[model samples]
Target: MKKLLLAMGLSTFSMAASAAMVDFNTADADGNGAVTMEEAAAALPEVSPDAVAAADSNGDGVLTVAEYEALASQ
Candidate 1:
């Protein structure tokens, strides 16, 4: 039971750590909560242009929450 509890606690801790929030106010290179291709590039310049373009969901020329989540995953 102790080992099971420890494992559960560790799992929860790891999930919380990995689920850290991404701050758009700071991460928004274009001063927009939504990130444009250019802005996303500035946030993570190492990422390929194709990757940035792909991140622009809704086809609004900006990264939506889904896109930001995708970036966070990377």
Candidate 2:
């Protein structure tokens, strides 16, 4: 049973990894390939302000494409 569960978990992980990802190049506005606070908020309007701030690692009040991509990849 343990082995079966492990295999199922691995299969689920593989399926998740193979899923299509939203291209950051297209998501980033202003043609800078980075997501500013306004851009991030625009892209994910449903996200709370606190969540947006949390994603801003540098505390620059913005999230870059790379940063958003990293978050999505996880």
In terms of TM-score, the best-performing candidate is: 1
lDDT of 1 by residue, 1-74 (tens): 85465446545654666422433443464465787776565445456888777767667788876777787577
In lDDT terms, how accurate is model 2?
Answer: 0.59
Question: Candidate 2, residues 1-74: lDDT per residue as tens digits?
Answer: 85465446545654665322434653465568677767655545455657767877887766776677765454
Candidate 2: the clashing residue pairs are none
Count clashes in each candidate, considering only residues at least 3 apart in sequence or on different chains: 0, 0
TM-scores, one per candidate: 0.57, 0.55
Q: Rate the local accuracy (lDDT) of all candidates.
A: 0.61, 0.59
Regions more than 4 Å wrong, model 2: 1-22
